[model samples]
Target: MGVGGRFGARESCGTARGVLQRVLDADRGVFETVARRHWPGADALLPRLSRAADHGVLWFAVAGAIAASRTPRARRAALRGVGSLALASATINTVGKRSVRRARPLLDVVPLVRRLEKQPHTTSFPSGHSASAAAFATGVALESPGWGAAVAPLAGAVALSRVYTGVHYPMDVLVGAALGVGAAFTARALVPTRDQARPPARPRAEAPALPHGAGLIMVVNSASGSSERALALRAALPLAKIVECEPQALEDELERAASLARVLGVCGGDGTVNAAARIALRHDLPLAVLPGGTLNHFAYDLGVEDVRGLARALERGDAVRVDVGMFSTEQRRGIFLNTCSLGVYPELVRERERWAGRIGGWPAGLLSAVRVLRADRHPLEARFQGRTHPLWLLFAGNGTYHRMGVMSGRRTDLADGQLDVRVVHGGRWPAVRLLSAALAGPLTRSPAHAAVQVPHLHMEHVSPGTLLAYDGEVTHVRGAVTLRKLPRALTVYRPMP
Candidate 1:
């Protein structure tokens, strides 16, 4: 996992465990009374608080001013404090909630004793109400230390009420407190320091970035899944050129992409991506994939999805060079950027084509798939990188594999210059195999699975041309096609993210 994701996860687990430990051990009835005594039942307060926080968090900080609204000066100051919390809630809390979906005790484990409270009955992770309250209180106090003295108690009470009412646990309040305080502090810091008179100097300005020189040309089969979305992107990134291609127009599209966009972007089915990537070497362009089709394995791996996002990325997306794979038969040469499937997968693709034209989407797709999946074996002779044995199903992927419909294996580093291949041997029948084995999330613990890394791959069948698919398209080849690697081949639009 990335460091940011890992730290966020670790923070979540620690917070949840700490909260649960308190709740699981605490005397439940007592906890409820304590939260209630602070300012009556918090049920009435939280719903309103949550709505305001969604709008902005400054109100949470300003609640103290509301609590002490006797003098006109104090009332005005408290109102401003509320505004700040509102801003903080909308900008900081909302973003943080998505980043850390820590649930509340009531939502997770403890059952609430209902009493007519209006708390949200949704995902209880990290309570937004608590955080907003804490942050607003913290900011108001910072603005005027005397304000802190009054709001601090209120903030603590609000956080505690969540746990006491059985809406949130002790840990939920603590996380909310920390989040609020942190957000208030961060906003304070990010904003210009009110006390400092002389401004801090900024570093010298850098030169405007030079043009990347060349971009990837996208050839989309608009009829495929999301490629139809590309039309919206042209307006966003005027620099990008789009070529709508049919199955037979692969070569012409490749030629245009090679000449125009240095990196060829494909928006279509896996077959279309493979077809373009197959002869990419001869055309001499790198292949950038857009997931515009159903079951987009190549686009999924590429990390570029949806046309709007793709257009935005083009404005700031980096053009990173990645390695390409080659597949060749005796007389024909092709590219397999996603995977080359045998047996069930190859046969499934063929059978589904007719159904695809007939019934649309997952309904027809599922029915067609059940036919191939229900069968036991598709006997075929295969080898990996020229050595292996006679295997039933051998899939040579550019990198990675799938199990029970889930994408499996490490997302291979596109620039690593290696192909990730998987060999599967299943004896399970249709319904049985789908249910028992790969259906659940996560790869099967330790099945008869092996991953091999090879520079070159070749496959042959007993008869003339066995059904071989790149991505998922079954193309007509003379007899054999050689798979080769192309370094720094295509240019694609991708953001740093």
Candidate 2:
């Protein structure tokens, strides 16, 4: 570049800075005048409020209270809220304050008795308290609307407190609030809640009534919580044949039930229900679900919440057609009713299982994530659609998912005939990048992630014997793998109309 071009660029930057500085100075004058007009209650209340918000104590207390609730939704909201507050505080205090140096409002205009007891010494272009307040409120709102609404007024007061206490100008609080909101949104994209993305499924139609399980063969897991309801089921459908099997013999028992039954009934967790669905599809028989496991994700979606509901469905013969996911490789081939995942996830699952008994599900999973994520594991080298990339995780759902959050999405129509595929592209700090993308939102638009919906996919692992998981079950496979959807291949009974 010529000397003249360089000189012109420098001059333009100087001019822009000068204009911004002038605007800042004028805004400061107006806010200073506003601060000087101390109202009756303002003198006593604003200072104390400002002190409460110092170092984000007020926001932390509120978030802690919400987090302490036994309700899952309240707890999820707390996690998001705290995460947002942490992000906003880091940005405003470390980055925003240091980037631009600005002086706080002069205390001379305020009454001596009304002076802020504890004043901040850092640059005040952006107010950290205000930023924290906005971020926490916005994050809570994103997770739970009612809780967010309740906290909004307090958040607003905290933001305004900075100005009222004469520690920051109006514009500082305004800009800080925007930065806080942005931080909350960024936090949300990276650490989304699955419950929010997936809501309860509404039943399509009532099942046709059947004669007390006349042609049904119900496979019950004697070890499952659903087993407690076995007698109830038998009382409800005396003619139905019930086969109680242990966990070790579940597969064989299901296979046996498949050959003899007209409608195969499953009473277990998602894993058991999933196994039954695959068998029912193979034998071309309708499947009835009796919710007897923790979470009961599949049975809940099937619209049969309990044994009674399942019995009602069987009496009515109410059913729905749903898609299944197929996985085929040289060493192994199977079908999944929910999802298939490849990469770090299988390892995480294994780690969780090892500790799930000791720590419980969610806590064990969290510890497992911390353990798996801290390790310097190499990304899985895989080929997809004629392109090779290092991937942290590759997930494919059976059909178009309705609720797309951190967890695999939920499908409204089980027969959508499309697979929801999401891949996290590997890069520096692969785990951190993956976590950020997961929290932030859709990975397709993100450089660290890619997503698509297709009828089928063929994936090839560069190395042999890589671990893969389907419906919470993991296995090792070599070389090329294929996944396709079997549209309307399974008939499932639902109780609701």
Candidate 3:
């Protein structure tokens, strides 16, 4: 090489080293400045706050409180927050810490009062606590703006505490928080938020514009634990007749209300809504659903979230026609607004109901799942498309259910006039087969399960008294049952954009 070429190469190398040294000097300078600063109340608060966030105890407690509100949206927000936190924490420990093996800052400049009683022993390039805080806050905000706003202050304080307690540099907290936000977005990308894919407001229908719910009669299933929502509806619509009834009296009261009212309204879970939908269909009355139940699948898909949402729809006279699903036998017929399933799921539902009253709902569901999966039960024998097969589960939704990341089975269109039929083929291990089917995507065929979209599904020669579950309710059917869609059969109230 010539002398000039060698000198030019040396100069470039020297310039790169100078820039790197300057960056390091600036980083250390900022750390020292923060360490020496005195904030009035931080000495007493920041250290304890940092300790509370250890092992995510604070976040988990917050999640439990949010879920205890018993609203579907709140629960979802809580779940998403935890999911994002998990992703961020995993990435920080696995990749962020390992990739950058930077040393912790010297504590000589930091105030003794502000320092944590026990210092962090890990590398200090990126802050794990800051990442968790940012991820959780961002995730909650994506799902629910109000909850996110409520949580943001705490998340910020936690992040600030990392720096105030001499545990993380400002850049560490900043980069960690950025990575945390990215993790939340990544989780949302995997499982899109409800606002990301709202159901289409199509096939508009005509319903009376009941100002203050003048001619509306609503039935509240008291047994379904919707008294609070019923009261809210009453306060919102003073003229509306709100009848609260027990489980046994729900049907009778709904029938009476439908006969007397210009509009039929119902509050409770999916089961109560299902009953109301049937009466509304028979009387040809437009239905206004107030979601007062856990997992209000049908009402959520219809875009009716709470009492206020339904109230706005009623006042605005905004309504849409949606398809209803029907499963009929020679002797009996029933309709489902969400989904209908035959097999282990129905058995699981029955088992859950039996134990739900004794041990509470969540625990009972877990027990039921374990019992049903462990029980010595044979698969259901049925004929599908001229072929007889042993099936562990046959699920048919009123509309096509789409997968959102790890979370599957959410519908974007409720009036597509098609039934989503998913079958988990019989296998030796029911739990393994069910898990595989759940993880599989829509329309993807695996050894354990297969999914298809069809206008209708016909099953022949089923055994007498085969259990069937539809929209959280269980029943029995036998001998040549057919599942079909009633296109745009039900008119429901929803706030339109």
Candidate 4:
């Protein structure tokens, strides 16, 4: 792959990117209302939080109910070590923040929804409270054998409390937690004691330095079900940095891939392929198609006819820019704001969402998909831009679909700054026809595949079965829907070849 792509933000995120912003708002609400003088910078908070967390996690992990829960010596060492390193990390971060000196919240004069009860003291660039909570929590996770499992949630709750109480910005909290986790991990790494198997540091494979411009690596998941696409990635692209996109981890990984990618690829369905494009904003990474599962859409976009072609794409591939959709959030993870549905498709996903390992793998997902298509492809009312759109089904996209899909064609240009919207006014017959055409394309002559493309549209499931699909996966928000364009809001990676 050769060149790069561009991206932008969605108007939707402006309104719905509330998870972190809400936390910030909450901080302004309660904390600023109470205090007027100062707030801690994110950096300052990390060191302090790290020290506190190290103390708490290490102590409780080995000394109390956690240890009594049956702690192993090596695990105990890793936990204690994690705290020590966290403290060191805090020292470095606090000094760094001080030097950076970002402005704190306007504790003194900023308007509030309510009157202040008191005042606060410290810088406000980063959230000290959040950092502390994250550090403390992560440190605990590092050290606790098993019984102390409650630490993670407790820490997260405390961090949220900081936002709820108005002590720190959401970014501050995230940064602080990052510091804490870094410290704990560093501390753990320093422990001479894995005294166990060889540490990652001592591994033979690590001999190759990850060059600053290391070749871009993409890990696509294609398994229709719960096969370890992750495992496949770890095995095939060991040199590439690893980021897991298991349903729960997709958003985080997408963010990482967008930021660090040279090329991005997937291993799942058309959904997974589309999911990758959702975040493929501006990083302009050539996409490499890898087939691990089934119905690989983005893979198809790359012109890889089969698994063998997937390998060939990686070998003799060229870089191409692609369009992507953006989302506000997912009930379980990050939202792509595009179509990953469920009413019809979700019914299928739901059947096996909980089934895991081999028993809950591909067969189950396949069976579920078929059942939902046959039983739950319920039609619904929809609204777009502003008009009512009566429909049997709908799929609004971020990128234009010109000819083929992932692996078959190029990833559409991302800088075009638009949404690729497709709607299916489906009924039983059309659905059947569409399915038949999908299996054997000559059926395209049928009315069932009444698919067309547009930009900036909205959808709603009035008849409601559960058709909310976000970034290729199903979600649970049914009713009048909205889809707004956020042009070029993100960045993705491409190869330099």
Candidate 5:
């Protein structure tokens, strides 16, 4: 309570108020400057642009267009964009706007033509439009740089339109953009990007560097709906022989190609790739995969995403040796490059195949899932390890499948020589147990499901007609079925980072 203490406290309070007043003065000055400035075509363009951004219509349209590309990476980028936008929008509405009760800027100096027809009636401290634009652009860029580059200009224009329309001060848009970027990073922290979760490059292998794909023979499955990609690949590798065949003739065409080629190549989905893998193994040829299907799990995991990536690998002769998963019974045997499963998933795959040709892939998959889960089904009984157990599903991946954020499963290392086995125990509600197991993912033991990594798995006393799905193809197994890995057995082409 002394004189000196009281004076010092008063001085500090006065200084803080002075700084706040100066900041407000500067922010208002900048707003007035932008409002009075004459910019060509902005009067007509910015107001319309700002109006178009209302309720995120512009961003959603952009996302839809990006998703229509039909590439996995494009789809992922679109999803990430929307996810980031959702987070930023939620935060702005819930916290940013509420915490600061600032009013909209004065419209006296702003050109009437540049003003929006219907002004937003909300706090102006942080612009929600700017936040959403920044979040979407940042999120898309995180997943795909090319798409991000294309989207960033639109985002920037949207943010600037907020200020140009006399709706927000410069600081509002800047702070909103900063918060938007923070939201994108927060979204990424919750679900790591694909590049962040890429597996380590190890156990490299050797293969011939065929410039322009001189000795590569590729078979394209016509049923997989990859004709456009096949044509692109043909243009990329002019010297390579490209054979397009029907579904029934795929195996025979692959056999013929493998017999005549130095490097066996295939373009299609996982099932077509599986057939090609078998042929490649038999001929002892290094395989080149071009992803041309709805879900190219094997091709994607191998880092051969498109014709450009595969062409680069072939030109540089870059390659790696990866493990192959095999499942065998008393009557039949087959190899898988991705995963094999028994139980509900196999049935889903079989059902999907039935309707896929008729209704198209994505819609058919949705229909199949609904049909399979609603039907009355019984659990498969089999002996596992040393004891018999009733199981609703048994999934064995060629390599340990890692869970990333909301992503179901992805393998980092393809040559780790281990099988990722997950079993959903039989329970009262099949749907609930299956959903729980899927959400739990790998290396976690739950009442609904248990996951384990093993070099081999043995299941005995299975019925003769038990269905098994491997690499998106289904087959029947009887008696004892053994699943094992072939360590570093398959050589495949890929670009090295």
Candidate 6:
């Protein structure tokens, strides 16, 4: 670069170092006093604690334990903690240490008895161990305040151990702790927190029951969980026609059933049910949904938790009319029963699916969020509400999903005739806003993000070939897209109150 630029950079670096050294000088006397008078037992124990956190094994073990716990909230907090640690480590070890290259405190100042068995040789203005501890603790707290509270003491202990062991100055430890907290917030922005449960879906109108599923054809997805319970499904609705189909043949099978049966039924997860909803809409046939997916969000909302539940609903002819979300791009038009989105979420879904089989969905989802957020930084370009700007995610929910944590939940009214439109606005620190939303939710609202309920929205000037995810199915769409609610367009079987 130029001489002026080089001089300016050096001046800035010098100023920072001067300030840090001044802080260290002020605390050095107390740090030395603590180091000289350390207890004999702690002399050995403190070093071991430092080494345990050296490669971050301690934090990883703690995170793994939390993730392995049966509690869902604990698992989520663990992932968030780990993700924050990852960010802190990267910043402290690579960026902070390399750029500043601050020398470690002289061991001579410390008492002979307090000298560590193995002191670090690298530049050490900031303690990486302190950073990791602080970041992990802060990240966990963002997810679960109670768990965070539990971890705070340990985090403080770890941060203090850096100075107690004579490896880092009090200032270094303090700076590391600050960096760590910043890392946790950064990770939060990238990964969404657990979605809170919404109020139950409100039942709309109902239809008369059919006898033993007579004249009803059910397309069963063999890949879905229903296949394992095939016998139970058959026993539940013996008179209904069941056609087992693979993922590839699901649409064709549903189409054939739509033409042949008076009522079309589907036994699968939300994605499968979403497909069935489209066909049911086109064929003007009422849908019978049997809850069979992992979460069964849609089926549960429809009040069909099992085959028997569906049968009872159908036998009683209890059905409800629900709104559908439609998004049309230049390539094609489609429908959704739950939600659609662009930006970080679609990539998260793809990553989660890739790992879900090996580690299960929730854990895989957390892992995927970390991986994608750490790697994917660029924002997508899209135009909405007459303005073109970068965005992290633009979500449109069928019928207005209630905001719950980082994700949305069940709509109180399924036929509300509105799309829940939420966008994480792109800005100087889009990730920060995203993380704040994930943690604090709508309470973090500002110019950086927005959420609204609307009957229709036209998203113009979208980049061609941008991926739009709807009901877990991703479609590459180019150009402008229209998102509108199909008010009470599809009739679906549900239990009567």
**Ordered list by TM-score, greatest first:** 5, 3, 2, 6, 1, 4
Ranking by lDDT: 3, 5, 2, 6, 1, 4
Q: Write the per-residue lDDT of candidate 3 for residues 395-466, one digit (tens) a residue.
A: 999999988666767899999999999999996998999988888788899888999999899999888889
Better structure of 4 and 5 per TM-score: 5
**lDDT of all predictions:** 0.56, 0.80, 0.91, 0.47, 0.90, 0.79
- TM-scores for the candidates: 0.54, 0.59, 0.90, 0.38, 0.95, 0.58
Q: Which model scores highest in TM-score? A: 5
- Residue 241 miss distance in model 3 (angstroms): 2.3
Question: Mind sharing the TM-score for model 4?
Answer: 0.38
Tens digit of lDDT per residue, candidate 6, span 105-202? 87886766566678888888788999999999999998878789988988887887888878988878899999999999877666655332322334
Highest lDDT: give the candidate number: 3
Q: Pairing residues by index, what is the TM-score of model 3?
A: 0.90
What is candidate 1's local distance difference test score? Answer: 0.56
Number of the candidate with higher TM-score, 1 or 4: 1
- Name the candidate, 2 or 3, with the larger TM-score value: 3
Q: What global local distance difference test value does model 5 have?
A: 0.90
lDDT of 4 by residue, 231-339 (tens): 5445544555544446667656766776765556555566665556555533544444443454444443333333333333344432333334543322333435234
- Residue-by-residue lDDT tens digits, candidate 2, 39-76: 77777777787788877788788988997863445777
| Candidate number with the higher lDDT (1 or 3) | 3
Instruction: Name the runs in model 4 displaced over 4 angstroms.
Output: 1-295, 303-318, 327-343, 352-366, 373-378, 385-390, 397-422, 426-449, 460-465, 484-497
Location of the lowest summed lDDT over 10 successive residues in candidate 1:
197-206
